[model samples]
Target: MLFSFEFSPIAVATLTFLLAGFVKGVIGLGLPTVAMGLLSTVMAPAQAASLLIVPSFVTNVWQLATGPRFGALARRLWPMMAGVVVGTLAGTGFMQGSHAGQAAIALGVALMAYAVLGLTAMRFAVPPRAERWLGPVIGAVTGLMTAATGVFVIPAVPYLGALGLPKDELIQALGLSFTVSTVALAAALAGGGSFETGTAGASALALAPALIGMSVGGWMRGRVSERMFRRCFFLGLLALGAHLASRALI
Candidate 1:
């Protein structure tokens, strides 16, 4: 694994990761949504996903492991985790062909639509009985996207947020979701022969800036109002989605 001391790409990747962390720290979700969208503009979608795995894992682990509500989050989110695992496996295997760029674009557009609907104040009610299916459905989406593009978790977060859980619990749930999906994705990539030793090393090097960004963002989380953070986060997502859509179309 040769570490390219070429500072330019590293610098850009670091900055992007930091910004993504800032958004996640503020809004309780969206590290992959932001990071992958931006990184994909410069790096290949698979490369962007690989670069982000370590940082996302580290930061989410910090959030989940340190939180008092970890146990409750685990209990509540097991179904979603299972779904994420399944979806990730499916995505990694079937979605990893050379034609995946088109799929990434499609996924990005779908995410944009979801963001737009949220901006429009869309509403839906899950029947008490149907709620049992939510986790698996979301997990499946997250996993597939994690393997194919890395922004698939956006559709699930809003529904999870609407559940009206405590803030800490929500963060822990997000952490758990990210962690589980990332692990599954790593396994899938290995199984599919998509894991590259050089890329993984580069990704590890890029993790430093992402960690720095997470620290800064976590600090800001304490200072900013949740409403303001959420507003900014969604707006960022809108911009990211639009950018990706255009990239896909061009």
Candidate 2:
């Protein structure tokens, strides 16, 4: 049977990658964050995740590698990374059944959480001692949340942002975290037999649009104040999340 989904799966996937890529180019993150969130509006979480696997992994790897401190960050953040891996695998199990409504709701929750954090302008720092204990816990939650919703920001992004790392260090750290979660999510989905040849092929093709969009967004980045764009982005997320949440609940 053909892989059935809403909104012309290819059309949805293509636009999603393009838009998500542009956002990443502009903001330096959100390939999966934007892809999964918007795609979830029209497809199941599992399929959205599968579509996400390739583009997210490749870009984030680039994001991590170019940062000049992967080794140090890896050494420092290993516990959280490990926890993300484990948590992603565990939560991905729920996706094995691939419940669309549940997946939609989970995505909605993740989107809302991200938007709320982004809009609030609330920022704080975790003391180093507390990070030792809190990092892994936060990672686990982020992993589980990503697995369920296909949106990996939520507490993870907020928590990481709160850690008071220098600007470059924070970017690398996020890339590291996103890389781990993407790999783990891929593993879980593959293990569950979610990818057929057609779906996998389409996912591979999505990288094209994603990369193109990223390039455009990248070009626009230095030309604009991302602060205003980010606010608009989160507001959009808030609206999309509310729509999804309502779909799930009502």
In model 2, what lDDT does residue 215 have? Answer: 95
The root-mean-square deviation over C-alpha atoms between each candidate and the true structure, in angstroms, is 2.7, 1.7
Candidate 2: stretches off by over 4 Å: 1-7
Q: Please provide TM-scores, in order, for all candidate models, with all chains considered together.
A: 0.85, 0.94
Candidate 1 displacement at residue 61 in angstroms = 1.1
Q: Which digits, one per residue and each the tens of the lDDT, describe model 1 over residues 136-210?
A: 887787777677766657556666666766777776776777788777877776677655787677767767777
Name the best candidate (by lDDT). 2
Residue-level lDDT tens digits of model 2 in 1-250: 3356555877878988999999999998878878987887776678888888888888888888888788888898999998899898887566547466777887887788888888998897888899888989999998888778877786888888888888898999999999999888888787777766776776788889999999999999999899999999989888988888898889
- lDDT of all predictions, in order shown? 0.71, 0.84
The clash count of every prediction, one per candidate, is 4, 0
